[model samples]
Target: MYSLHLINKNIGKFYENIPFSGLTSLRFMIVDENVQDRESLKNVLEFLGYSVVSVAGYTEASKHIRAGENYEFIITAIRSDSCMDFEKFLLSVKDFLEDSSVVIASERAEESCFQSFENDEKIAGAIHKPYKMEELERIIKSVRQ
Candidate 1:
């Protein structure tokens, strides 16, 4: 026999009660110094269907943030040049309550840096350098949840 085309007649009823219900719009940014890394991350985030913005360094990232924009996630790597003051940038991010997630890519296993940021009570996670795409997806999903 042919497959039954059973439709959930009650599907539309699911939206009946909730006054505020919609697909969670996820917006995020990537702040990385290395051109390759920055671009690669941007491409991956976009591929994963996120509203992504990117900056090359901390200064640029700060400018974007100060422009009164909002983002649900922030993925950053250690600064490479003077374009962004890394310390100040980190502090600013820590100050934002809506900053749901952050993943810092470091060059080495300096768990101290990760620990320090995570201890801030806002920072959610950190991804060390040379991570796999799967890792990124996992972290992003965790943040969204």
Candidate 2:
């Protein structure tokens, strides 16, 4: 079980035991071509006690990696309208993604897709589009364990 705390910046007061990952400070980056989806997911993650940074496309996301920013988890869209190759993108950032969980989110992901990245130690899980909040939370918790 994890517990979350909210700290008041202005007063420098700490609100303890807010009911999510109290001990862990999880940072996440979201790479999705869809603006709406990216923002929506970012909001959900922030609400769930994660520090999230979201980018509109692979190019922007790569810039973050090039800058040497590290994240505890990365959630990316499998297929982008810009025709970015998901696997290639993953490989390109493998160096900066050490020990971080990678989750692929797609509307058309199949079992074969999961198997394809199964051997990659960074891949933590896959979620179909329109996933429930509970489902996403479950995957995150499972990977953390």
Candidate 3:
């Protein structure tokens, strides 16, 4: 089971300005290495009225997106341990939409991280590691806008 500490912190902090009110069509995917992180993100997104799916790493993340469906949001983590390039993982998601919203999470989210995808406008934004649920909500709302 995933830890609830981080997720509990985000309770009630849903994105208020969802581009589409009611957002019945907002589907999200949370891709991260840690089971706890994935579960936490899934819970938070679901609470905010989004239909969510989750995967543990890049491999599964790619599979889910490649299943011939479109998801409104993708929240992923940079996995230095997985031998996969974050850029490549993101590229795999490009077939979905040119304006897809992606929120990348990293343990050390330095400005250099932003530099990596600066050329690719599809990458909506990033989240630093050890994030609270509220922070995730804010990022999602900002990126969706």
Candidate 4:
């Protein structure tokens, strides 16, 4: 079993058995409209040894995707009220993202189009907000696998 050292609330610091070398080469992208949440999650991911890039919204992230900045995994917050549409963005970049894993993060996860996100083959996992260490580790492990 794995454990953690909780930070504030949006993310967790994982001390799992994942090798540091294994994580160094993996790239991650975080997309969230909230700056504080994005930065906080980025810090924890970095501390756990993964390289992370953060963008405020899907539109900005899509630009990077189009530019060919590939990522092994992407964690996005799909909100019901956000101005951006995560589904639309994902569909637009379907070809570039075919092999990449996507994990959706949200507090209001059950309310939006994300309600059926797990059914989408593009997604690797989903975690509710007030993040938990196990869920984070589980997703990372799947990505590594």
What local distance difference test score does each model get?
Answer: 0.62, 0.75, 0.67, 0.74
TM-score of each: 0.71, 0.79, 0.75, 0.79
Q: Residue 51 in model 2: shift from native, Å? A: 0.7
Q: Is candidate 1 or 2 superior in lDDT? A: 2
Instruction: State which candidate, 3 or 4, has the greater lDDT.
Output: 4
lDDT of 3 by residue, 1-145 (tens): 1223322444333233323245556788778887766776676667656799888887777777777656777778867327567877777668765445777787785779777876776776777766455566576667766
Instruction: Give the alpha carbon lDDT tens digit for every residue of 1-145 in model 2.
Output: 6555555443344545444645238888988887767776676567766799999777778879878898888888887646568887887888888768988888775779878997888988888764345556667789877
Clashing pairs in 4: none
Off by over 4 Å in 4: 1-6, 9-22, 80-83, 109-112
Per-prediction tally of clashes = 1, 3, 0, 0
What is the RMSD, in Å, between candidate 4 and the native fold over all Cα? 3.7
Q: Candidate 4 at 62: error in angstroms?
A: 0.1
Give the worst 10-residue stretch by lDDT in candidate 4: 12-21
> Which 10-residue window in model 3 sums to the lowest lDDT?
1-10
Q: What is model 2's C-alpha RMSD?
A: 7.2
| Residue pairs in collision within model 3 | none
Cα lDDT of model 1 by residue, 1-145, tens digit? 1111222232221111111112236777888777666666565455545678988777777777777678877777855457445566777655553665667777688787677677655565777764445456566667666
